[model samples]
Structures are given as structure tokens and as C-alpha cells.
Target: MSRKRVAEPGPLSEHVPGRKKACWGILTSQGSWADRSPLHEAASQGRLLALRTLLAQGYHTNIVTIDHVSPLHEACLSGHVACVRALINAGANVNAATIDGATPLYNCCASGSAACMELLLQNGAHTHTTHAHFPSALHEACKRGYSQCVESLLSHGADPDYGVAHLGSALYMSCLHRHTECSRILLHSGAKVNVGRDSDSPLHAAVRQDSADQASVLLDYGADVYLRDSNNQRAVELAPPGGKTHQLLLTFEVAPRTLCQLCRLHIRTVIGPSRLKQLPVLPLPSLLTHYLEYT
Candidate 1:
């Protein structure tokens, strides 16, 4: 990536005569965020040495552009762990939000930066945002199939099934995007298999996306095949004829649940999803432990 030339002092100075050509880097108005300071540039470009120099010179770490985006937000968005660490160490607010409700933590979630997420969480960045207008960090992580980020958010107390205004549950987003691993993580973390946007179940999303693997995972977690969506369509109705998903659904519909499968489900219910990780050490037979943990 070509680095943009830096204009001195402030963002407004870029409009000065004769500086127009050289200032093209930020000429786009810092990606339209507006009024970004030198700190934002250093952070966004991952210029760690220059950024540290700026911080040493007493530049404000928490300074915001017109959109209220801090240097930490810039660093997190770019997935620059060094710049993020420098900003946080210099007192940048980890929880600072843009005007549109994007926080530094949210940027980290979008970038799939698990290290940045852990650092932010340790600094008190909220795992769950009360921003009704924006997708939660968990939702972003799952939607992008950032499985590590998903696990980190879940470990930090993010609600697995918290629905956004229009994005539905994190499980639904994962299933809709065909991210089977994310969907599995959500299910194992106690996300309700059937609760989704309005009426579209995770199974419906899986079927619509034609992800037979996701459909199988959701079924194992007890997703209902006969559930109706906003359009009153069941999962089978959404599956393409003769598709992998269609075949799987038809087979499932034809056969009853196996005794072993029911036993596994019942055992998982008794153990609880939160404590499933403890199954390996329960002093039971290895086969039984594997069955419970689905190892």
C-alpha cells in the first residue's frame, strides 16, 4: 500500500495552496471522517515509530475527528496492534464511539483482530454495546466468520442470541452467511437454535444459503425444520430441489431421531453448554467423554 503524504499541524491545512498535490493522501478527507489529526494518520497507516513520536510529543491520544473517531478507532480499523497499543497506553479511550455508533472495539471486531479485542476488553471495552442502531461486536464477528473473535466476545459475556434491529441473532447471521464454524460456536455457547429474525429460523437461513453442513449443525443443536419465517415458509420450502441441503432435509424428515443422538442431546442439556468444556475431565470413559463433547 502506498503511504499518503502527511500535512503538518491539522487536517484543515491540507487545503493550502501548492500543498494540494502532496496532500492527496488525506485529500479524501480522511476517508470522509473529517478533521483527522496527525495521530489518526499515524495510527491508520501503522506508522508505529512516528505514532510513538507523536505520543511522546504530547499529542492528545483521545482526539477525535469530526465523526468522533479516535486514534484508537483508526488503529483498530486497520488492524494495527502496535499503534493500538501505543494509543491505549497513551490514554486513548477504548470505548470511544463514532457519531454513527462505531466504537474502537467494534472496529476490532470488524477487522477480526482478536489481540486488539482482548486488549480492549482488558481495558473495559464493553463486549456488548447497548447501541440499538448498530450491530453488536458479537454480531459483526459471527457475520464475518471471525471464529476467534466470536469466541473472545462470548468468553467476555456477550449474549449469543442478542438480536440487532434488522440483523437478527449472531447465529442467524453466521448461518445466513454460510459460516458453519461460527454457527457451531454460537450454538455451543447457548444460542437458541430456533430464535432468529422475526420468524426466519437459523435452519431457514441455512437452507436458504444451501449450506448442508450448517443445516446439519443446527439440526444437531435442535433447530426446528418446520418453523415458519416472516414469509410463512418452512426451511424445506427454501431448499433448492435436489440440492445437498434438500437431500439432507428430506432424509432427516424421513427418519426418526436416533437413540444415541437423543442421548447425546439429553446429556448436553444436563451438562449445560457453558460447562461443555469440562466434559473431557469428568473421569468417565473416553468414549463417553467423546460422545458428550462431540469430540
Candidate 2:
């Protein structure tokens, strides 16, 4: 997507008058020039001053390009918090989606911007909005190892188990990418450790990454060690021979859990996924709370 600054000082000029028409260009697969807009340019470049000036001049905040991408989408995708705030305050639709169905919140996740994500959520961005053939915001955050973005989305009521079409859940994406912190935060947020059918489980994805740390986090959060994949192979069987992941899985298979670990798992199950966050302040000892939280 290319943004051509208007040469004359119109109500939506991005530069000083007569400043040589510098254009900020973004390479894209879509060759159609009809998708470009001045609002998009201002937001994509984090031009807060120009954006506000345009809004003050009565430019529509909800204007979209040919593909239906709004200025709010551009601002959030670029991680421009000030521009995002300005657009939202000017009545931009926080949940505006592109023609491909990518929402502004999804763009924020792709950018890994917790501030932009938070601002969009505060302005009523829908957490359940999913892109066509793409995952939810939480899934995008996990795939990119954006732990803060994951936390922000989760805190604002994003569903941890919201799976992508044919791509499994956020936990699976985190495990697939070997993002230990992202996996940990998802587990803490009560994501299913063994979600998906057969080979699509988070454990299976973790084994595919050959990451002992990521596998351990899943196992610690109560992932089933003996679950079979589509090929009837267990996660341990999928691990590379003599690898750290294989060694770690082998040990886990043989070692019995401590009484504390069993109690934590049981408590988590009883509390249900959404209520798991309340355990930290449920009159329990701080150490026990930390242990339950896997801190």
C-alpha cells in the first residue's frame, strides 16, 4: 500500500506547504492503487499532528479504502498509540475490518503493541473478531511471542481457546513457535494445555519445535504426556532421538508428580478456566498462590 501525500495544502495535507510531495510507501501484494487514502497515510506513518488536523477539519474517521481498511486499522497496525487514540476519540470504528476480515485488534496483535491493543480494547474493540483464514488476536500474539499483547488481550476477556480455522489454539501456536513466555502466559490465563484433536494438540506442537523449555511448561500446566497424534504417535515418540526434548519427556514419563502439583491441577480444574485468575487473591498464602500460578 503506497501513500501519496497531497502536494497542495489541503485540509488533509501530511507535509508543510510546497514540501516536495514526499511519499511514504509500503510494499504490498495488492497492486490496486484504489486502496490508498490520506487517513491511511497519516495513521500508517504515526503522523498524529496531521491526523488530528484532518479530523478537526471534519474528515470522516470511519473512512475506509477500497479494501475496507480504515484509518484505525492503519494506526493500530503501525503501533501508533497517539494516532490510534486520536482516531478513536474522533469516533473511528474500533472494530472496523478489512475486506479480508482482519480487524484493528488483529493488526495490533500482529504489530505486538500492547499499548495499541489496550487502547483499542478500551474503545470497545471486539476480542472475538477473527480474520478469515487467520487466527484470533490472542493466537497472533502467541505466534509472534508477544507476551504483553497476549496479556492485554486476555485481561480484556479474549478467549484463550479461540482457535484458528484449521490451525488450532493460541497455546498450540505458542508451542509451535517455541515461545516459552507466551506459552506460560497462556497457560496462566487458563488455556487448555491439551486442546485440539489428535495431532493438533499443544503438546504435539511443542514436540515439533524440539524445545524442552516449552514442552516443560505445557507439561507443568497439566498437558497429557500419553496423548496420541493422528499417526498414533505420542508426543515423546515424535521427539528427536537423544534430544533434550526427548530426554525431558522420558523423565516426565517416569517421574511421579508431587502432592502439591496434583493439588494445583485439581484446583485449577475445579475453578474452571475463566475463574482461574481469582486464585491469587482467594485468601491463600502468597507462596501457594505463586506456586499455583507457576511463578
Best by TM-score: 2
Evaluated at residue 86, the lDDT of candidate 2 is 89
Sliding window of 10 residues with minimal summed lDDT for model 2:
22-31
lDDT of 2: 0.81
Query: Every model's Cα RMSD, please?
Result: 5.9, 7.2
lDDT of each: 0.81, 0.81
lDDT per residue as tens, model 1, 33-119:
336678888999999999999889876788766667788988898899988888888888888877778888888878999998988
**lDDT minimum window of 10 residues, candidate 1:** 1-10
How close is every model to the real structure, measured as TM-score?
0.84, 0.86
Scored against the true structure, residue 57 in model 2 reaches a CA lDDT of 77
Per-residue lDDT for 258 in model 2?
77
